[model samples]
Target: MVVFFFVVGLEVRQEFAHGALRDSSRARLAAIAGVAGVAVPALVYVLVVGASGGEGLRGWGAVVGTDTAFMLGALAIVGPRLSGQLRVFLLTLTVVDDFLAVSIIGVFYSDEIRPVPLLVALGCLVALWLVGRSRQWSAAPYVGIVIVLWLATLSSGIHASLTGMIAGLLIPAYPTQRHKVVAARQLFRDFWQSPSASSARAVGRGLSKGVSVNERLHEYLRLPTALLVVPIFALANAGVDLGGGVVADSLGSPVTWGLIAGLVLGKLLGIGIATLLAVRMGAGRLPEGVGMGSVFGGAALSGIGFTVSLLVISLAFDSSSDLGRQATLGVLVAMVLATVLGWSIFKVAARRWGEETADLPMTLDSPVDPEVDHIRGPEDARLTLVEFVDFECEYCAHATGSWEDLHGRFGDDLRYVVRHLPHHPHGPLAARAAEAAAKQGMFWPWLDFVFTRQHALEREDLIGYAAELGLDVEAFIEDLDSDEVAARVQRDIASAEASGAKMTPTFFVDGCRMVGSYDARPLTEMLESSRRGGRTQAAKA
Candidate 1:
């Protein structure tokens, strides 16, 4: 449970950093809906269980959230194709839901607090925060601190569940810096030339440092927790003997019925109505390719909670008690009921409203426009290659040579388009500079120059480049900081996110994305093959 919760924390933090939480409107929408989702269900749980005046009211936390892994897995297993945007929207929602769920457990379900050990744990978390902020690459101090922290938390009368989550939350998560990747590439080149053990070790260290600790831990821990820890824990703890009269008793018990109603009905109505109200009230809009029917179906799906629900059950009541046994039966029944309800809702919505789309959307959302977009070749070129790039991305810099090679091979036949997806810290600054240069008819030249000198992308350095290129430095600086330039760059960034181009250097050839290597040879071969198949920009247009 600790490991699983730790992975959950990592996922929520990732979403907060890069996914839904990054956008203000989306965050607002998610916040409103998340609060409603939890609040409405809690109300229902309290009402149902409270009226009976039973101890079952203690388990209200169980109804407030959907198990993210279970929910996402079920969504994938079921239909709803081309749901990339929906997935992002739901991921953000779950981040809020799960964060609330964790807080509830920590505050409501904990044992008596031990201030001494709790303070010690708090100090350890502060140390972890400092380590995370210091940007240390070595994992030794982190591992040591976390081990001590976990032990302290266990001794602090806090539930063992929160230690991992708190630790995961304290770890900083962010996009990979381009300079680190560039440095790693240099190390790899060195190892390629002089294949020594020392060189190999250097390459390994570089690669490790190129990625954030949060990502590394998530990549390593997610599978182990999912495949091993969760299954083992569920089997050992989640088992309830339904063969006896327990099912009948649960059916009659307010405890069982309260949980059932709260999850199945409350989650559905809460999320669905809250989402509709929020959108209608102009709080936020739904993700693209998602409609109300799909939202309703997904809301129904959210009721199938598992991990946290089970954890809450254990914390709220003893398994040996009648209330606990009844609650377990309710949860098991709710999973089946929610799944069936969600599946039925999806089928009905698909057939009645025609809102079904079960595959990922294949085409880019934003099409290339020659008038506004940078274009190197003729407008009537036979082939079109559109790339979304982060200016400070190392891979984008590495891929700059491919354009020349491709153009040299098929100069008149290909027109290349560049769009911004400035996901790094300095990417927006760099993109604005590029646009500033573009206003002076030097977009391509600036691209080439900056790709070579990626290390020097400060505002002053960009102005220096404009002067070196014999442009009006004053005008370039003015335009570089202009709102219009910022808006223009933001459009490309938004387009990149919506277009399903996840990485920098993503290439779309003749309106189709290239899935494999973006190297010159691979792209040339792809282009040649497309031509043989009678596919081209003009042909498609």
Candidate 2:
């Protein structure tokens, strides 16, 4: 009970602080996608079970599960062939999908309620909160208290594990004093002056000294829950015994059929319909170099229901019943099938799209644009560093400082070029904001803002940051809404593909690609080597 509550609390905090639900649109879309994915499968399961007169009809809801880890892992294996935008889209969709699945279990699957036990559960929660408030209790006492809460909740006919989620939300998770101080300082500079400024400064100072503490914590607490607890739960619960009649029964049963149909058929339909509607309505466009087929394929993969399905089944059915067994089998089979189909479709679709052609050798006789010439120089003192980066990529945000360092060190001698490779669907807006900042000659500052708040990079946040930077917010928004920005982003993506810069934060010094993260030492080595080579070539000439 303790662990589960802890995890749940953490997740709630994190979602508010950094996870997908922070973005209203992304969250809404994810909710929609998740609902369609779950509802279709569930409906199918119930119908099939009812038709066959099978026993697991009550457990139909268990069929709508999504294995984000497995799906993302599979996408990773598929490599750069899959568009970055699609990957981000899948991630956002899955996070919300998980949340919805959990809610369904909590609301619908609880046993018959007795008011006495429920009241006791609330009392226990209050006690636990008071204990947590002290911040002095050892982990042992908390664990024991949690166990008690779980038992109480279990006896109360409420799902016992829900105690974990409830407990997790009630706990406090605040950022360090240093971060608070930094935030205060930034806010003060951006917003207030005079008496307000003085007050803000005082608050900042207090935060710096770790003297003042805010009772309400910022939302990043969910990271621990999602990263730690969710995975553990998955590992513990997902190992089903596939031997004997279990396999046959799962295939033959309505529960299995419904799950399969919902996942395989519903996911694609929902995502496809939504995306098509968005595009048709002029709300969004297909990502550059990404086809409808690949998008559909990725959506199909969204049907991979492993972790949530198992959790739901556990909650909804008694262990001794045939319903539980059927639910388990259905989940496993549907997940396996979804994975295979999605992967195959993506692989074939990506191959058909052809390798990114930007990096290929070009004939010397090819005409060069004057603007391209203006940006290029052959001098050894001048360094041309091109970055293929996604605005929504966390890793890219992390590496933003490294680029800043290079800029500070090299100044005018370095020509840093940014090319868009928006990895997630939300990235394009961020990319547009950066471009808008570029129009106002504040691109770097805007870049800093977006990267620092990457976890909170919603469209409104992007626009708000632009406003904070003193850019014309309306114009910036209009530009983002324009196809011109998207075109520029696409050109950059094609250029990146040509240069073999497949991942975000990919750096090319001259023409040599640098993949993944690197500190000052390696960066310096690469730069120096490039300089030496350029000098040697000059000497030969």
Candidate 3:
């Protein structure tokens, strides 16, 4: 729990400081998607169990989560042929999803507790905060403190593992000024040097700095709480003894069926329906080189329930050994089904679609043409505004809001574009989902949806949103498998880098770079200046 919570804190900090949570809309969508995923699944589980007069209905909460490492690892094995955008999309989706899952456990799964232990826990939290703020102690002391907190939470009826997250949040990932200075110097040197030499130097320096800064910070920030701790918990708690009497009981349990059905069926239905509605309403469009087959293939893949679901199961039936096992079974079944179904769909689509034509000769190293107006003012009012953003990048999402506000204020004056810059291993799939939304002309709507629910962006929830958007379910699935869109997304990422866009929400104001979110006052000022310049040129002509 201590490790996990620390990771969570780190991830959260990263999100706020550098990741997708910075984009208000992205964050909001994640939160919403997370909630929808969790709520719908839990509801389904409860309804099924309740209708069947099953006593294990309470275990419905356990069947949530995306199992980031497993899912991403599988996708990774598929190689860059899969859309990088999709990977980022999945990451943001799951982060929000995990956040929501943990919140649910904290709120709904906690036991009747005494105030004394709770106060002690609070004290521990304060101490952890002090450690983070002060950067006084080495990694060992923080680790020890986290263990103590984990015990307290466990004894207090709160999940003990949650302490891992708490402790993680408290510990500093980049605890000292020296670390930051060194990192900055290294980054500067790398920028001026060859990639190979820079990378080698970075590796050596990073190690010698000691303290496992990223890992400790991840633990301090509770990112590991979600990624590592949650996964471990899932594996431990989810491995139900199938021979137990609970297996028989689960056969008749509505919660079990509901969780299974929700994850396997409902996710597809919700995402599919929402996608269709979005397309029909003309809010988004399919990726330029994608079709219905890909959508469905991706949606099916979205059902792989691992981490959050297991956590929910643990929480909902913390005491009911029988019910917990049943929930675990349901999760296991759903996960397998989702994975197989999704993979099968992807394979078939890839076969049918064959390889996408790489006719657009573009790569990350391409230069931006000054004459092209790629950002702001739609060529046609109905044109979309496509963006390639990084989730672990605050600036990317922050820029997203500016575009969104512009669209809202201008109405038909603009549309949206989307791409992905995972920046780190954990951000790709969520970004893909956003781009995938483009396939059905519901990209903006879906983006809005997920951003509003940023806090809940879970893996299952992302799939659920895809289904809810009712994209050409099959095409959406295929798109996830299709390398064409991913390549396009990659091209954009490269373009952004070439253009020197280093933050979230980097804007191309009619193809010229516009950095950061600006209020109307500054925006108008710049606009007027540009207008004046245009007039002066015309007059001279």
The models' CA-based lDDT, in order, is 0.81, 0.61, 0.57
Model 2 residue runs over 4 Å out of place are: 1-27, 79-83, 114-156, 160-244, 282-291, 318-321, 351-378, 381-383, 386-541
TM-score of 2: 0.58
Q: Give lDDT: candidate 3, residue 27.
A: 61
Q: TM-score-based ranking, best first?
A: 1, 2, 3
For candidate 3, give the lDDT.
0.57
The best candidate in terms of TM-score: 1
- Candidate 1 per-residue lDDT, tens place, 1-541, comes to 7778778778777777776687788898888878888888889889998977857789898898787777777777664754556777777887788778877888899999999999999899899999999998866787788888888888998876677787887777888776788799899999999999999999999998988888888898889998998778667657887767888899899889988999999999999999999999999978667878878778887888777788898889976577888887888788888888877887887899987863234466678888788887999988888888877777762345778888899989988889988877888899999999999999998888788887777878878899998888889999998999999998887776666677788877777766657778878877886777645442222
The residue-by-residue lDDT of candidate 2 on 89-151, one tens digit each, is: 666665555556665666788889877888888888887678768752234455566667777
- Which consecutive 10 residues in model 1 have the weakest lDDT in total? 532-541
What lDDT is reached at residue 462 by model 1?
79
lDDT of 3 by residue, 119-201 (tens): 78878888878776775535656666666777777778776545554454455553234344447556657755766776776
TM-score of each: 0.80, 0.58, 0.54
Candidate 1, position 474, lDDT: 88
The true-versus-predicted C-alpha distance at residue 143 of model 3, in Å, is 3.4
The most accurate candidate by lDDT is 1
